[model samples]
Target: MLVTFDYFLKNLDLSNKNCLDVITQGQWLNVHPAALVFAAALAQKVGKENVIIDNTAGKSGLYIDRMGLYDWSKTESPYHYSRHEEAGRFVPVKQILTSNDQSKFITDLIPLLHLPPEKSQVIYYIMGELIRNVLEHSMSKDGAFVAAQYRPKSNVLSFGVCDTGVGLKKSLSYYHFPKDDVEALKLALMPGISGTSMSQSGTGDNAGAGLYIVKNLSKMTRNYFVIYSGTAMYKLLKYDKRIERPKIHSDPLDDRHSLVDKLPDFHGTLVGVDIALDDTSDFNALMEDIKVSYSKALRERKERRYKKVKFI
Candidate 1:
């Protein structure tokens, strides 16, 4: 029988160790940006001196090298190629440790993709939120590892961001008590739910809508967005394009998604998103829609809370 994505996720192990050992299947192998960043984040945790790759036996291995994963590990690249030639093709594995580095990386990223202002806006919105979450919340000293790849054939842009720090359950422990990683993920994706503060309207700086907005944006564009942390993974399945306007759900479980638990425990967080450029909507208009939706969701949630009161 064929296995689901959850099956693989359940099998993925990233335990704390003094060294990192990477082994990939031979023959055909497809590597997603999420996996790449996850591996990079693990390597950063163990130090490059303790990282090793057991095999580099096929075109897949060469692609890994091209993605600059070798630089993160102690393994030497078996193939030699000009680094300049790889430019503009993809954002290789990059480590961003501070806000300044994040800003500079975003600025330099646009030209390489050669995207027009409108298209680049989506990238900026997605990336800005993804990186900022790691910087402010993850509490990982190593920070975030991010990467991107644009496939010309499909016209889809893929992004991955990962951090080796306290996962969602721990992050939400301050104000919310989630039974497990999956429950924490649900709260994390809800608008106005932030670990930084107990207020629904997050501290002046954070509205707690980063992940919610990004996932909703992916749904609006009929794309895929995945968030994995603490042995649980929640995937926003691609929306049906046939629907003229898909209803936005305040509760993530109401949307088309897959939630699986009991996976190998990962100490941090990992996110993977794919955006179809052709389906991307106007950035400003989309943001406005998200704002309205967020407000409605928050209002409804509050109403539900009020209804639970005993008004005798």
Candidate 2:
């Protein structure tokens, strides 16, 4: 289990350091987009450069100790049932990428999925377009990406992406029509509107097609997308039960309340997404951990295995 706010309290100063980033599934689910903007901005203001973050060992600050500490001999990943002796429901998953490569990797994320090649590739392209907004725009120095899949006897896999970078408010303002975190979110869903006029950093999506495509795909595929920034938040769900009706605050306002007016007091951006997968015979097995272009995380993992440590 995750430690109490004690981690937050003890690392209050480190929050600016980007030293502690942890949250429950519910917490991540309920994260206010404004917080995403704030955290990314604040992390930047405090000079939180990308420190070596590793999730393979569940070493990322957000993982529970139980989800973390592991015996070396138990080498098989718990994600595989054959290796399931005793473990928690979570593990650390990490990635480090340069801005440009991260953008490319976004496009690459799709083929790794079990979905049909066409769906996965197009999804990667769409995701790539959305991520282009982040890597090209969010403006934070460091970032992190995590993905996990669970088979509750259902035909689906869940995944998410998070980062500490320039948030939607700043990026939105970059285009033109600015709004607070909440309003910007609504604006994102609207077509033919964007924060930018012709800026390259943003997806430059005035037609609102990029976001709309994501929203539409989420509905068609029965996937879910939760977007947050600058305290403005929105969620689109496509389950069999009931499709979510668009909120009344649909037409997003201008950048009057965007999060960038005060640079030093803000945190970076964070995006969480989930797509569905058909239930196969073994939906529980994960073929791989996140595969980013960066190799440093892998090199570090190999190095750690050789470091002989003596238990007291």
Question: Best-fitting candidate, measured by lDDT?
Answer: 1
- TM-score of candidate 1 to 2 decimals: 0.94
Q: Residue-wise lDDT of candidate 2 within 1-312, one digit each (tens)?
A: 011211222233333353423232332322222222223333334343432222343322223222221211122223332344222222223333565665555544444333455445444544465555555556655544443333335544444445566666676665655557655666565543455554212353334445645544444445555554544445553455453322212222321111222123224444544544441222212111111211333344356568688999
Which regions of candidate 1 are displaced past 4 Å?
Answer: 1-8, 307-312
Q: In model 2, which runs have C-alpha deviations exceeding 4 angstroms?
A: 1-119, 143-152, 198-208, 238-266, 278-312
- Write one digit per residue (lDDT tens) for candidate 1, span 184-267: 999999999999888889998887899999998888878788898998899988777898656788899999998888888889
Query: Clashes in model 1: which pairs?
Result: none
- How does each model score on lDDT? 0.84, 0.41
The CA lDDT at 248 in model 2 is: 18
180: Cα error in model 1, Å = 0.9
TM-score of 2: 0.51
- In order of listing, the candidates' clash counts read 0, 28
